[model samples]
Structure formats: structure tokens, C-alpha cells
Target: MFLGSYFVLSICYNLYLSFFRNSKYYPDPITHLVAKQSEALVDGFGYNAQILPHHAELSMKLIVNQVYLARIIEGCNAISIMILFASFVLSFFGRLKLSLLYILAGLVLIYAMNIIRIAVLAIGIYKFPQHTVFLHSIIFPLIIYGTVFLLWVAWVRIYAKKQNS
Candidate 1:
């Protein structure tokens, strides 16, 4: 029963995101601003670049080939992180008051991780442009998803145990 409702809500929220909200998935105003600022900073520092349409606002940077690289792949896109966190909570934690608190905390941690991930990737790309694709798609996703997976594991192990106790 919980799973069914969670699935429904998640689907509906995603749908709302796809349509009613900023279609680009900018995450939040802060991330968008940061992405834009980062682009400006890069250009100011003499790196030719432009901001790209991103999965989350302020989350992607487009360079010479129009390659869209995530500005903050670690999960800085707060909305996506929050949605993912909430989905995880709903799916795994069930409907509980504390679950929402956990979701909020998870989002904050995920956002911080994303900031670090993007900084690393940006440096990596500047240092080894040849490996941008590898870093952008494969490595970055693995890191962010892997971190989220760990959070989920911890949440289940700790929170579930506490609830049962």
C-alpha cells in the first residue's frame, strides 16, 4: 500500500516537474545563479564558454562543442535531490512524520556533495579535456548515485531499526 502511493506520488510529481515547473529542471534559484556565475567566472578567467540548457537550473555548462557538462553533478540540483530523497523516503521509509525530516536532511547533504562533485569535474575537465565525456557521464553519475545509494542504505539501517525498536 505504501509502495503504491509512493509510486503514484512520485510519478505525479515528476509529471508536474516535466510540465508545470521550469522544464529545464534548474533545481533551485541558487544553483541556477551559481551555474551562471560560474560560467561568467570561467569566461572572465579567459576560458571561452557559455551556459547550456541543463537538467536542473544552473547545473550545466556548454563549451566549444556545445557539450553540456553538469556544473554540479554531485547533486547540487536541489529539487532533483529533494525529489529523489523524498522518493527514497516514501518508497523505503514509508509514510511517517520523521521520514520527511530525514528527507530534508538528506537533500542538504546531497546538495553539498553535488557542489563538491561539480567543482572536481570542472577542474578535471579543464585539466584533461579529453576525458570530459568519461567524467561527465560515467564517472560523475556513478559518484552522485553511489553517494545517494549509501545514504539510502544508512537511512534504512538506522531509521528503520529505530522505528522498529
Candidate 2:
């Protein structure tokens, strides 16, 4: 069940991504949405942030204070992560309705965290350009993966139903 769900979800997302790349949508909708949300979040933190679609790539360039900090690509949107998360939850020992609800909640939490992650990453890159590699390649990925791990642990240890002998 897990493998089947993951495969189907991944294929659907890949198709969606492929369709968006050649479509009229600039930078694709999810990437654009994530970039815009990050811009708003960063702006809320008093940073002058703006998102502009990158011409050469299907991504949005996140500019802070007129300096290019990062590019918000489709991968940054966290849909694929959510799909992996859903597959795991659905394959586990939980009631269908409850597991579905948990998956929904987990996805929302991850999506929100990804946006904040992008905002924080952009701010970090803008302020400390030297730590860009560490922050981007290490810290931020941990934040998102850690979120999924915690969600999985919660599902297994706290949410999953036990079997009766």
C-alpha cells in the first residue's frame, strides 16, 4: 500500500510539474504561491522582500533589499514531501478516517513550516552570506525533514491503532 500510494502520488505530482513547466503559468502555481507566501512572511518580519519570476528557470527569485537571496523552485513547495508523508501515514496502522485527517494536518504543518523555512533562509542568506551553504544545505532541510520525522513518530507511537490478538 505504501509503495503503491507513493508511486501514484509521485507520478501525479511529476505530471503536474511537467504540465506546469510548459504551460502559460509563470514559474508554476505552487512555486509562485510558496514564493509569494514567503515574501509576505519575510516582509512581516520587517525585511524588504520581493519575488520575481526568473526568466531562465521555472522558479521565482527571492530578492531581499535588492539582493538576490534565493530561488524558490518547485521543489521548495513541499508537495513531494507531503506525498511521501501521506504514503507513510496511509500505510501505517491507523484508521482510515483518522489517518487521513492526520495526513491532512501534517501536510498543512509542513507546508507552513516550508514557507517559514524559506523566509528564514532568505533572511539568513541576506544577513550572513557566508553561512548560506550551511543554512541552505543543512539547517533548513533538517527543519523540514525533522517535521516529517516527528509527524511519522507521532503517527506510529501516538496515533496508530494497536492490533488485537
Best by lDDT: 2
lDDT of candidates 1 onward, in order: 0.63, 0.89
Question: C-alpha displacement of 135 in model 1, angstroms?
Answer: 0.8
lDDT of 1 by residue, 1-165 (tens): 445755776686567545534534464445565566556555655566576655444245545225444454223454555566667666676457777777777877776666556655665687688998998888877777887888889888876787688
Span of ten consecutive residues with least summed lDDT in model 1? 65-74
How well is each residue in 89-135 modelled by candidate 2, as lDDT tens digits? 87884677777788889999999999989999999999999999999
Instruction: State how far residue 25 of model 2 sits from its true place (Å).
Output: 3.4
Candidate 1 clash pair list: 25-56, 25-57, 26-56, 26-57, 74-114, 75-114
* Best candidate (score: TM-score): 2
